[model samples]
Target chain A: MTETRGEPDVEAWAESGGRERAAWIGWVTFAARLGLAGVLFWAGWTKFTEPVVLQRQAVDAYQILPEALVGPVGVGLPVLEMVLALLLVVGFATRLTAVISGVLMALFIAGIASAWARGLAIDCGCFGGGGPVAEGETKYLQEIVRDVGFLALAVWITVFAPGRLAVDRKLGL
Target chain B: MGKASRERSARERIAEQRKLEARRDKQVKTLAVAGGALALIAVAVGVVVMADAGKDEPAYTGPLAPTSRQDDGSVVMAKEGVTAPVLEVYEDFQCPACKGLEESSGNTIKQLAAEGKVKVVYRPFRLFGQDPLKGNSERAANAALCAPGDNWIKFHDRLFAEQPKEGKVGFENADLISWAADYGVSGAAFESCVNNGEKGAQVQAMTDHAFNTAGVQSTPTIVLNGKNVTDQAWSGDDLAKAVQEAS
Candidate 1:
């Protein structure tokens, strides 16, 4: 009312035509970072709530890791996931965390693909914890696709951890 | 346009540049310190989980408990002259989760039996009724039935250790006989018994009794004192605790 550009926000409008586009991009990255964090948090929390044996058995179903390594990975992976989610939520070292998140999702995709290729009828015991094995329904493709989506979101945050409300922005990261 | 104005503008530009460099420095320092702290926390959690996850079941090697095969093809191992609660294990060798359950709780069950705290009855059956997985389960269950009484538990443990990937062909008859031979259980009779599928009928009967009569629809099921406690017992520690509470 005092003396606008006959518009609501005069300062931003006067700056450059690209400012609005850049602002949109920032908001998009912000949404992505938080979305990825929420999914990771849910993934980690679900594992925490399930019986440890279910996770252990799920990891064993992959049959990739050595017998000695399976137990520790199954036990530690969810906790690490939760910590990473917390970091992503706070945007602390966001690019680094997103890279890690992307890598984790990539590994999951690879494991699922390998299982599918080998005709292993076993199900992955992660994410939601493999429920009872349903005959003739591995659903490997669906799992891989969902993980790919998560991977995309992680890549978004890695490329542009925007200055919306992130701690990284405050620290000039 | 004078020299003083130009110099003042130059000074302002330099100040702005300096502020940017200072902000970048702060970002680097903050990131390094915070990232290092996170890495430490992750590593600490990993080490602790590893310590907790990979616990070995103390193998009971003190003495041999008398084991006998019941008419239903179930092997019962209980020290004679000791009356204790019965802990029944219903498992299929080809079931992946069954292998996990055995790995996690097998030694505990054996120890309980060896200590005469519980009577262990291993009921190996074919949980898989479909092909791919079905054949392996049937062969392994039949082979288990053919194992001699004294070393039956050893044979049982060996089968679990040698389990193949789900839907894979495994527990071939020759390997079954060889495995028995390693346990000092080999002979022409044992080989013929395994090759000819002599215990196939027994295995089939046991599977039926387990699924239909015993109401076991899943592998790696635990029955302690005639009550299914599989929901509560997932590890050696869990097994030990549940048995203590029940018995």
Candidate 2:
């Protein structure tokens, strides 16, 4: 006696292409986010363990935003990085997390670029002790450019993917 | 069944479907927003931590006479000079870890030097002895030998301070010259030594001697009181103890 749109038209819903497109985008986003998160998490952990070394390098490069903000940033960055990394791996808030990651990567690239431009011969301090350089050397432009590319990928994830396999999707959002 | 009854049933079914869809949508949106907020907060925390890290700059409070050359290439000593145990270290200009040791432990060494507990004499060794032209090690060594009176220590410090981490060649002549100028060394003299390879043979002989006679196999090999302690893992304290014992 009642018409119910024939089980919500499963074939039609699947054929609209949104689901397929989202799947593809979601997978790509997952890979990129996971990769970036892992790298940042490693780097952040190293720095957190050796805050003194990182702080010294940062000051040497003159990358600190302001003289006053240095101490707090050093202490808080590692915990933050670990949390974000866990979120990304778990596919929690994938799009938003990707965007944040992209922004952070962009900031890092900018910092490296500025240091290179200024000829501050110091390590990037992205990773902890005994970096690619022995010490007292600036990161090259090539490394910064590579980061820019990664940042672009992250931004792509933010725009196209909606974290299909994430908690959001599980919640039916 | 009556037509009205059928119509009423259809309306009820439609309402139930709409309600379910609305609930699902709400759940998804909430999850998305909440997860996103958590990630953003993590990023925010990371940025803040990095920012705060810049505050604890290591201070060089050692009692070394802060020596810097004036514009006219005159050496100026900040504190009264003292007699100390002597330790001569021969190093290459382009060696990366040399730079690290210098930045990390240079002040501590200087403090020891200033206190008359130790004296550090840096002998330059050219690791890139194969390429005589662009070899930073040879050029730096030559410059130091040519202008030892004015630029030896300062030039030594600057070289480690500005050495490139890794590359095809070492610092260019221009960079070396500028660095020499920073220490009040005569740029012309530094350039000429670098160009002519003034201390090429001496540096080679010293490096060879270090290997053959002193068994020094590393850039940071330390000579404690004329005895080559190359094999031992020598720290500042170790050197201090050796010096005290020798004295």
lDDT per residue as tens, model 1, B1-247: 9999999999999999999999889878777856674786578667759676556566666765779988888989998865568888899988777777776677777777888788888888888877767888888888888877777888888898898776567889989888888889878887888889899989889888899988997877899988998866667887888888877
Per-model TM values vs. the true structure: 0.85, 0.51
Give per-residue CA lDDT, model 2, range A7-101, as digits (tens).
Answer: 23533443355977656656776677677778878977877666243444443344446635644654565666677677677766666777777
How far off is residue B160 in model 1, in Å? 1.1
i-RMSD of model 2 (Å, 1 decimal): 6.9
Which parts of model 2 have CA positions greater than 4 angstroms off? A1-40, A43-83, A99-173, B1-91, B95-101, B116-123, B127-134, B149-151, B160-195, B205-247
Task: Give the per-residue lDDT digits (tens) of candidate 1, residues A1-173.
Answer: 57646332532442344877767767877788889888888887788666666777778777788978777777777877787888788777777888888999999899989987877776665575653354677888888899999999997777666437787778665
For model 1, the stretches where C-alpha displacement exceeds 4 angstroms are A1-31, A48-54, A66-68, A128-135, A162-165, A170-172, B1-6, B9-13, B37-41
Output the lDDT of residue A152, model 1. Answer: 95
